[model samples]
Target: MKKLIYCVLLISNVLLFNSCTDDKPIFIADLGSEKIAFTNNFASEYLLSKDTKNNIADRFIWNASILGVNSNYEVQAAIDEAFTKPVSIGVSKQTNITVLVSQLLELVDQLGLDEDPKTTDSTGKPNNSGVVYFRVKSKIGNGGAGTQEIISTTHMINIKLIEKVPTSTTCNPLWIVGDAIKNVGWNFSKTTVCDSDVQRVKVSLQNGKFRFFTAENNWATGLNFEYYKGKGYTIDARFKSEGAGDNNFDFIGTPGIYELVVDTSKKTIVLNPSGSFWAVGDATPGGWNFTGGETAIVETSPDIWQATFKFSAGVFRFFKTQGQWDINNNYAYYKNAGYTIDTKLENDGSGDANFKFVGTPGTYTVKINAIDKTIKLN
Candidate 1:
């Protein structure tokens, strides 16, 4: 009977071991798995806009940090004052989550990501190429009855500092009314000046075209001229002589038979005109006077003759010598009723001559050049 009892106990032990083996294996879920990721393309430094939603399971959280030394990282989050409320399309429960973000070089600790915790090394050291980490947790409850914790997957985003290249663009100068050539982006340095940048873009008035140049082939700032699009006026230039070796000269309030010469070699312009000249005895010339006026004389060479006078809008008649035809109007005549030459009887040939006008209250400049022997105004 004792042997039978011992055998029975052994049989029961074997049965129990077999039963345990037949049971299913226990499975543990990977709590370190991530459902989402965040990546920085290094496009813009500031947040363009928010793209968050109110859905519980579909919500997203983003953070960044500049990796620094000694485990000190400056952090910033997408949930700053700029993104106070999440952009929502439908009704959903909102949960408060803090996102720490900062420059990439300051990040120290990194959460467990889905694939692997990408760090400077396996021991969590600083790396030349930095990483931004985001930790998010969701809570759903009102007062105390329905509180629940939902933790998001940790996401590690890789980042690298890169140097940007400069760029430029070019286009034709002429465009139709109400039309615009757009998207001409240019890269500019902090030290660029308006004159240098303007000169970099060459405008050809002869061919109505422009050329842009830069160091690289990138999108550049573009410029275009719209013809007859709106009300505009032409820039009329003239010359006036204060006196010999005198830089101060008033612009002649007349336009005709003037010499428009631009010598780019010396960066100077000389305008010489003949016949009726107007002058103001005082500093301000309100109108043309026939007597008691300062004589407008020509000066030495290499002078900026056209730049001496201020310009305004008005019709000015200039005395064109015989055989000197007008470019705009072909009609040419001498001693016509409209043509008036006031020759003073001064033996010195330095007397006041006035040109009469019946027009609007616009500005004008009369240029008299004794060397060129021509009278013109605009």
Candidate 2:
């Protein structure tokens, strides 16, 4: 009876193992091949001088991969046949992308394809006259599963040659138009001159929006350029006012007195906080020590500063800040006591002599022109 019971239990265990094996499902390989390709939708030629509106440079037409549900596509162009060094012309999740003629020309020159004079056709004619190669790449996955990459075949096209138009070197007049700027006076009609050649101004402004203008406080008739906000200190901010129409640049930084450097020729605007100007020496009313005692120079004009004080028989110079005699702080000036009365402020590292009070110790007034680096005594 014991042997018969053990045999029945072994049969039951074998049947349970067979049932478990039959329920297990097999996983077939679902891998798919990713293939990408590009097509030239327009003519094989392009000219830089032509200003046509709808000149199609190239169109990237590719097949969708079965494994990739939402694959990203990037169109590439290069000078090499292997596309080892290709420039990305456009990127999108769509299977097709159309590049403009202007953009393709820019890429051709950037890839150094226009500089090659060795590529020739069957007739020995130079084919390197702006020959460009195009390709497409597809990336299949978004970090959720296995990622696969595929590259397309290279396509070639010739770009026509044209005369290069020179960019304008003459700068137009620029003005700052905003409600936050008030210290320099809201007289938008007045162009505040900061540098001799570079149009600039020192204005007290609040954290708000501002923009550059060609006309006085007018945005419709004149040229205007707009850029994004939160630009760091003294950055060479640049923008083209050609197609920007009428838009204002956002300023979301701390509010204070700022120095604006505007160049219309290069279409750039740079802003830096204006450093404090003080008169610290024997001739100043605050004495010769600048550690604690210093005479603050009031900014009468944009970059011009003025101060009036009784002078003793001694020497003095200008200080940008109160701290030390580093390059950014203190400097001497070259003074001409002749009929012209010119003062050459030492901005270079050249050592200069201090301004000497030659007259008798008495009550006198002094004016400092920080822009032209001149001084007037009366």
Residue 96 of model 1 has an lDDT of: 23
**lDDT by residue for model 2 (160-207), tens:** 645433444554557766655665333464455634336777776675
Error of 2 at 41 (Å): 68
Clash pairs for candidate 2: none
Question: Cα lDDT of all candidates, in order?
Answer: 0.29, 0.58
> Could you estimate the TM-score for every candidate?
0.18, 0.39
lDDT of 1 at 228: 10
Clash number by candidate, in order: 37, 0
Q: Candidate 2 at 319: error in angstroms?
A: 2.3
